[model samples]
Target: MRILVILRRVLDPAGIVAHRRLRRLFINREEYLIQPGDHSALEAALRIKDLGGAEVVVVSGQPEPDDDTVCRGLAMGADGAIYLSGEGFAGADDGVAARLLQAVVDRLGGADLVLVGMTTLDTAQAQLGPRLAGALGWPQIVGAWSVEIVDGRVRAVRRDGDDYVVVETDLPAVVTVPGRALEPRYPDGARLVNVYRGEGGMGEAVLRWDVADLLHPEGLVPLLENRGRDFPPERELGVRVEGTTEEVAQAVAEALRARLRGA
Candidate 1:
């Protein structure tokens, strides 16, 4: 089974605060700590490989030297990685990224399973996985913690609060994993050296279809919800006490009554 994961280079908090006033949410130029969501997705894919999946591939947004997520993805355990770059791809919303990723998948011969994080930290738009599934026309299940690739079929365990589920799907499907899937593993030191030592890295590097023109904001039209809501209202509390067990209840009621009267 071939698996694909989309990784993003996130801005460090200090970098964000430094330029937040400019309204630039990201500074992709600097080194990045892998987004936990991205790590979770990769971790799940690794587990699938460890359990016998044929291959694991990572797809990242950009290939700049500072893009730690893509480089580390190979170090961590992915068999290969693909990077996409183009003018109109900048500032792509979740749906747009999903669209772009679908294009990448088509060129990569599609995947047996696609893994994505539950939600992107910067955007908090937990919609990418489903959107990608929509674009790829695959059946998808969200928040999976464990996945098994069996004879070209997928059996995944998804958590719904305290309970969990086991679902089955054919190959060429999409799946979004939550942190519950598995913990990240230490870099495969020896394998890392061996893989990078080869020329042009693992797997073929393909540019895929460029969808910038089709994905421009205006081309899709718009119906954005109002952003930046006010914080929820605060609640105040008061305490009361009274005498004997039975009479105490009455006394507490009287005290509450008096307090309400005072108010």
Candidate 2:
């Protein structure tokens, strides 16, 4: 079985500060980490590979020259990794990414299962998995808490309202794991060292493909546009009301009613 996992890099939230009043974001330190949700997806893929006979492959979720994300996956026990790079792909949007990933799957001769993050941390956009599924015309199970393969099908648990529900899909399906659903194991020390230093065939396992080879000019055009940023109104100081218990309660009710009316 061939399992494909998509990985993305995100700026660590702890290294940045959001200035709401200034409507500007400040970065004290620029540090990148694997997207949390995607990390869980990788863990799910590794677990499946450990139990059943499967080859795990990692692919870049975006266009980046750096292969850090894929190399990290290799250290975590992935069989192979593919890096999608080139100038044309620099600012590609989700639609373009989905199309590119579909092409990669085809180039890989298809896969038995595909895994991706339910959402990205910075953008909080849960569109990649569904978009890729749509592009491939495959069944998708999103926001999975846990996943396993049984009877030639992929079984996953997802939260439905207040309870967890089991959902199953046939093989060759897409699954998006939720963030922090499963703890990701630490990478092997030797493998981690080799992958980062490009030694011991680890560097050879990570293949790079030019975006131009997979997409045309029309396909490279982004479907979304950034128009600028918007900031919320500044917070105001609280008002004080003095009176007995009943009087205070009545004052609060009246204040709420007035605010509602104004809204």
Candidate 3:
């Protein structure tokens, strides 16, 4: 069995500072880490592999220097990795990525299962897995807490309202793991060194595939464009009501009525 995992990088939030008064963001430090959700997804794939000898391959569309996420996956235990890059793919949104990754799955000769993060940290976009599932015409399970495969079928634990339920789907399905679903294991130190140094048979573990070769450049155009960040206006101080309980309640009701009238 072959399992495909999607991984990506996100900016470390600790390094950024937002100034509401200035209406701007300041970068005191520039740092990146594997997306938390994706990290857990990788761990889920590794656990599956450990249970039943499945080949785990990780794929990423992050640009050249951002291949760190895929490398980290390899160090953590992925059997292979694919890095998708090109000028046209630099700014791909979820829609464009779904199409591009669809072509990637085709080129990979298809997979028995696909795993990815339920949402992104920076953008909070939870559309990639479902979009890819739609592109592939496969069943999809979102926000999975735990996953396992048996008898050519996949089973996962998902939240339904206030309860967690076990759901099962056939092979060749897409599963999106939540960020905190599982505790991600640390990368093997020796394997990480070998991967970065391109030694110990780790050099050939990663393959670089240009997006231009997989699909026409026209298809790489993003459907969404980022105009810029827009911060909300600074908040005004609240008026304090000083009186008895009934008076304060009346004051609150009046304030609500005024706000509702404005609305």
The lDDT values for all models are 0.70, 0.91, 0.91
Indicate which candidate wins on lDDT.
Answer: 3
Backbone clash tally (model 1): 0
Q: Give the per-residue lDDT digits (tens) of candidate 3, residues 73-127.
A: 9999999999998878788999998998899899999998999999999999999
The positional error of residue 257 in candidate 1, measured at the CA in angstroms, is 22
How many clashing residue pairs, candidate 2?
0
Q: 1-263, model 1: which lDDT tens digit per residue?
A: 68888777565555543333444445445546666677888988888788775577788765233334666788887877776655555556776677777767777676788888887665566788999899889999877777777778888887767888788898788888775457889887775665455434442432233455335555333334347524333444655565688888888778889999999
* Candidate 1, superposed: residue stretches over 4 Å from native: 13-31, 63-65, 190-263
All predictions: root-mean-square deviation over Cα? Answer: 7.2, 3.3, 3.6
* Ranking of predictions according to lDDT: 3, 2, 1
